[model samples]
Target: MKISRWLVAVIVLMSVSMTASAEYLETKVNFSERLSSSAETLVVLVPADTQELSLSGWSNETAAQINRAMQVREFTGAAKQQLEVIAPMGLSVDRLVLVGVGTPSDLTRIEAEEIGAALANHVNSTKAATVHVDTSLVSDVAENGRISASIAHGVDLRNYRFDRFKSEPEPRPSQSYEWLVVSNSAAEAYYADLQGLANGVFLARELVNLPGSTGYPAAFAEMARAALEPLGIEVTILGPEQVRELGMGSLYGVSQGSQHKAHLLVAHWKGSDDQPIALVGKGNTFDTGGYNLKTSSASILAMTTDKAGAAAVVGTVAALAAERAPINVVAVAPLSHNLISGEAQLPGDVVTAGDGSTIEVANTDAEGRLILADGIWYAREHFNPRVIADIATLTGAKVGALGTEYSAIFSEQEDIIRTLRTAGENTSELVWQLPLGPYRNVTSSRIADRRNTGSPGAQAGALFLQHFAGDTPWVHIDMAGNALIPSASGIHPEGATGYGVRLLTEWVKIYSAE
Candidate 1:
């Protein structure tokens, strides 16, 4: 009997749920004495600028065999370069994979971690059951745990993939493998931190990849509750009435056209007695350009990821809560859709923000900053956080300039900006500082307090959001160009990149670290 369309939909949906809801890989990380002969594969690391291809740690017999293979293959310890070697005789190890670390003098921790990811990808391709990684060449004895943890972080990230919709999926080679780091020092604490951070990253990815029908404002709010409330977070959701009562007109105006009700989701984790750090995210679950309407089908199709900022906030908070780190953090997301409807605000409509500023709607598509204005203001009025950071997939100009490589960070605080940049360097979800000059006049409106999208191009979105951040120490990350990747790279697959989740988590975790 032929399967009906509805049945196929049901089956696919079930598979997707099973795949999407899968727990983040808690890849077991354990220490080893050395690259043992009994291992299925022995991954040997070579430091940069080596004159000879000698196997440093191996005994005479093993070293001689590996030397011959390297002589033939020309294996150098240059970073990201790898070659597989097989010692036909005298070693218990089955295969020898040589990886380069490009000139130890210039190697940073971030580069070390990337080399680790490369090693993981190499082993994953061969489907090795057990791998012994030599970290001696990467760092000295004192830095072994940090280096090993960095490598483990890479290995953990490379293991994530979203492939649930395929009728017949390809086998994942590394799905069942065990990873061992050959460092004398144990890295339990570092691994725990990475696991917590990655948990948030994967959660963000899953939310960004979901379709609009399932990942709408209401559903997104519920998702946050399910993820955060269980981790001892106090999750509060405000509906239209509550939002309207607080005079969040800019937020309510954007969602007036959509059938899905809008909401503001606040998650508070008060691990410290001190004032909290506020994280505000723009949650346009789907952006259809509202009354303005998107011009291209491709752009419209990609609208599902419009809420990536909110997804990141959800993920970062869940991670912070799960780790139970001794830091107070509050994550706020304004969830709704920018869509076409009879009740939708028009192009020239004026809406007042929670802070009592009127915005003339120049473009309905520029709605992310609208809701976020309310969210940031709410965080200020309600929580009175010590610091405020808002993230959004808000503009096309930033993406147009930076592509999907690095996110744009606009902040007046150099110290805060420096902290996030360091996080990007460590995590590889990179960020670049951009200018937010005295261009307030460009966003000015003769009739209203401001125009939704003024002539500042991409910077206008950040400027509009800056109005609500006010005089507080604030950071705004415009992730429009950096939210989704076109293809698989490192830990991210061909969908949502989970751009700012790790960056934000690390940024917030700094307080705890201090």
Candidate 2:
């Protein structure tokens, strides 16, 4: 039955012809010094300190009416707060949207992005055909068009929708926008780089949202090639034979039961002559937890998201390459499936990694660390990177430790940890540092060099991966809690959050700058 299913999947994949590009709402944005009187919706930015709606951007009569309404509605222009008026008494536009900019301190790039996201959600909900944003009043606080570009970037992030597999996808309303900015602000130039980042995020979300039937290891490699190679990225796919030749027994053992062959996908971008940073991701295309098995329905359904870390690696590289960042980086993804089959690795099986480390499979369900062991080893051996950061949805203990608000980061290097935290804060992909060395005792093994499973899941997983890092400055990010969300909120719509793309992209940019 599984073989027939695999054949059907192959036929379906081969027959389904479509460009492998990421799907996102392409909101037409234009920057102008002149504000248009005719618009389906007029979005006005107001500062919290500016009481009575006192501003030179609008007519006195219009301002007076809005101020009266603000008093009646008690709209103080708080951050992420808005006041909407329909068919305003003096406005030419059909509707008026009063969005708050909070205080001077709140007028930042991040705040601008959030405001943009909030504005996009409102505009999308209203299905406005054309919208005009008046940003003249914000020039004092917003510098160099950063706020304007960030707002647009947030809109792009919030506007993402993955409906490719929908038999009859719901039609989305189309809208165009114009940003009325201060003269010579160069908002368009600033937005160009942000657009690239949005593309990368969309790609990651699309990969994660894809159903298991269509997103196996081989298919993922092909998709990565199709999406990245044209952008000047070098993509290499190591098949089962090549994987075994590299002695990636630990990575290979996890896929022994699957009909779809495993793959070690390598993506290299040589943007500079500096030593590259290595990013290793655990990619379990569809994990059934081998013989241990995920008994609950929710646990089984969530298995499709096990490959999210790999998706982020692909996304980050794509973002950096598209922006033409001046930094060299390499991505290593170990892709496989842990399914129950006669050939699947048993709980007691001992496997040898590419780096010649022996691991005892104390729990068959702990397969992410097993694959990551080889991936990290391969990256350090082949790429000779200055730093190695491995990301994975490795353990449920991470969710318990940090919940869904932050990913658990484990690293002995203070510089890497601090840099990652700053990047996370800047991008809103938050991370919290966890203990690394104290948990090494849990990985001790009686029969092998180490054991895959131990007490305190998150730390054990991190410690297990640290052994393979081999003196390289490494940070292990267990993003099991934040990779996928239950519903749409903030900048994300729903399903896959694409948690690490923006965070990692920012990290690369910061690292490159240093």
Candidate 3:
């Protein structure tokens, strides 16, 4: 997951060459050019003036192609009112695409991107060997470069297919894109950072899409160790005995039901000797809702994705290492599977945590916070990190509050909250801060030191986990909503979303800059 700076540099270099080689064609009003004039598929930049059907130049093409291009124009034109339209002139290609670039001076990076993405989608469907996106109307070099990068990012991420287990796999198709940017120099300089971001996103998707059976605790740890250790990252995996030695009774209690032993994995990337930024993840490899159990088949079917938070942490740390960002980062992943068995910890049982705090188990289904508690305690007590953030599919209440669109964040630190919110905005993986204080009342128990669940209708379960984080300036991310996708969007497919990786990476990037 962590990328070395060296790898990032290499990827950037390749991107620059690729973008430069992709030619950009310019067309004036009333000009008709053959789509297959060049080896690459043509990209027509449609200005907003041409969005409406005028029939200035037309005829002899299938109505379906014209309609599809019109749909693209309508969709892109509404968003960017000044966009220009592009289409193939002759029958050399299967289809022609209309890319809309709004007004020249008023054009934004996002608008330019809409054109590029539209072009990519057009080429992908046509099975074209190459795509030529014309960007002659735009004058700003920086904006052009950003648009190219965004287009590439969208196309690459959206095209991802998880066909690993498919018996009848489709043959790999050969296709390439040629981006015609106004300024070649600007594109070259901006390509590296853009590619690094794309790489990070791709890595996150891969980690999240892996099946739970193949992504077990030990297997996950091994994957981390193999990918990171060679890149100067220090990797450590603590077995059951080691976890018990540290008094992680809450974590052990959850693992008692499953055959697979628990594992606490630590991956450290010391880009600086300064105080480390700590990230803890709850790794419930498979959650059958413990003794409470899941009622519906859907709930049980998707329980394997409970480890999504841990997967995000692993992927983020790997990207950081791979990018070689100059900041000290450490991740703690507490892995376990919640199943039913004679040895499983029963409800109402009180268990001691790593910090000697006892928790009353009101619901075995609330196991995420238990393991996360130990992980947070371990991070603080052992690493003494400057700031700690723990992510987990901690509560269904979070999903009830935010739906599947955003994550719910609970933190005592206002500055951290602000920074995280900004990062979320940039990445589109938004986080809405919720009240953890209200949940504290429910977590306070009479018999044990604390209870996982508070009052009967406790609304914010993310805050309940904050109680065990101590004074580590911790933030709890309830990823119950953001971990997977029920539908596809932008650059993400339906399945594991890998939501937090980009947000966390952006946050770390800002911290390193500071």
Q: Give the alpha-carbon lDDT of every model.
A: 0.76, 0.83, 0.67
lDDT of 1 by residue, 1-514 (tens): 1334543554344323322334445234566654333568877667765545544545777767766776777766777778787644565667878777776556666676676667667777775677766666555643555656666777766666665556886655443323344444455556666666766777788788878877777777766676666678899999888899999998998889988767899999999998889999889999999878899999999988999999899889877876778899999999987778788889999999999989999888888888999999999989988889999988888878887788898988888898888888766778998889877677888789999887667678888888797778898998886777777676655688777888888888774464
Pitting candidate 2 against candidate 3, the one with the higher lDDT is 2
Cα lDDT over the full model 1: 0.76
How would you encode candidate 3's per-residue C-alpha lDDT over 179-258 as one tens digit per residue? 66766666645555544454445545554565666566666666556555655779899988889988999898998877
Worst 10 residues of 2 by lDDT: 13-22
Give the residue spans of candidate 2 off by over 4 A: 1-22, 35-37, 52-60, 104-106, 140-144, 183-185
Residue-level error in angstroms, candidate 1, position 190: 1.6
lDDT of each residue in 164-248, candidate 2, tens digit only: 6679987653677888887535787788788778878877887787777678888777777767787799999999889999999
TM-score of each: 0.87, 0.93, 0.81
RMSD of 3: 7.4
